[model samples]
Target: MSAPTITFNGTIPQQYDDYLGPFLFEPYALDLADRIDYAPVTNVLELACGTGRLTNLLLERLPSSAQLTATDLNPDMMAVARKRTLAPNVTWAVVDISAIPYEDNQFDLIASQFGFMFVPDKLKALTEIHRVLAPGGKLIFNTWGAIQDNTAWAIVNKVLHAFLGGNPVPQHLGPFSMADAQVVLQALTEAGFHHVNATSVKKTGLAETAAIAAQGFIQGLPFATAIQEKDPSLLPKIQAAVEQEFSAQLGNHPLRTPLHALVFEASK
Candidate 1:
């Protein structure tokens, strides 16, 4: 007999939020903040604010009276974000980056964390972001750099891919399509953002064990949602297989995942 499994699983686990925030959020704060000349800043906006990690950071960095707006396309995630939110000064909005509701030049600084890639139309979203920024205002965003150098996620993905036979894919997204430098630059340039730059940064973190790391990836972004329609009975096999692979190599010990990220900062 074998363990029952799911081919298309959509269940988000309990520890996901905790793991995601530290692994991704806290480290990217400084990168996001440096884009703007905060000297005269009065208003700020963030798109794709996952669980308010970066949103809260911007709030903390803002002047006493500075106003900040944070938005997310996922209401569920945003709701979770609101609970852990430390900044009362932030006005969280449920928004689509491609079609921002605010007036043009309404913001002094526009920022995001890992949100630029999911947008359906990069150029439309960029123009909208610029439209809402005052002249000389800036846009700061981040994306996953590349797979080989993304240590933590790489291990997780390798396990899942190996589990699901091989080359597990969702729709047409190849592993690196969204994060490729050329695509990012093109989108920014066409969106009217100048001084475009993309650079890889070092990212590192510790997960207590291989299983925890695997679970985190299983429950996290893009991957879980992307595979939700593949089938309804193969998920457990995938999970089990990955966990076995991880345990065999790295057991229940602390795992440090060194990551690589691409930061893009530009002006409107």
Candidate 2:
């Protein structure tokens, strides 16, 4: 049997969004927008626009003369994102990067934040991104750098696993790590990007050891369901264990997890 498809609104409880809200969109937008300073941008494309965090930043940096198109595979996510009053500079669409629906050479700049790792066929997605970029266009994007560096996830996953009696964690949920960076870069290179490099953008996790980090991943992602497959009633246990461990680790605030953002910028 297949798993039930998830929606952005239904993925996580509102409580989790409140918990994860501080880290959600603002920082990602600022950084991705900052990376494109090397060239003047006229038209832009953004992929996997989860709740419009990066989209917010892109609009701020884009000149009033420019236009931005933000796309995501999940319409529900896009629907939630559409709420922002984004300076009349953004066009929102539901699109799958694996088969990008755009004419060739349409964008001067294209990017995403925390989006690349989610693609089902990464090579196909890269090819499509490349296809849509105009000559001399740039690709600036990022993914989770390493699991150990992200204390919020590391602690959450660890405690949840212990509650589940030490079951192995699935690879997809913790997809980006140091070991995977080389292959990720290679895939981008194979997809025809030149001058590829991954940069370190680290943030200290503010949530403490005991506080439930937020609703974002604990409730928002399909990962918890994956864990549930091992045990029919793991969801409640996972939630409880994560809450207890986080509370044990954090007393009244968010933990200070050192997170890294592995960034790559290159040209076609």
lDDT of 2 by residue, 25-100 (tens): 3565577788787348898999988777778777777788898999988776776677765477789898888899
Q: What's the true lDDT of residue 32 in model 2?
A: 75
Global fold similarity of model 1 (TM-score): 0.84
Query: What is the lDDT for 27 in model 1?
Result: 79
The TM-scores of all predictions, comma-separated, are 0.84, 0.84
RMSD of each: 4.7, 3.2
Native-structure RMSD, model 1:
4.7
Regions of candidate 2 where Cα sits further than 4 Å from its true position: 1-17, 163-174, 177-179, 208-214, 224-234
Model 1 lDDT at residue 124: 83
The global Cα lDDT (0 to 1) of model 2 is 0.69
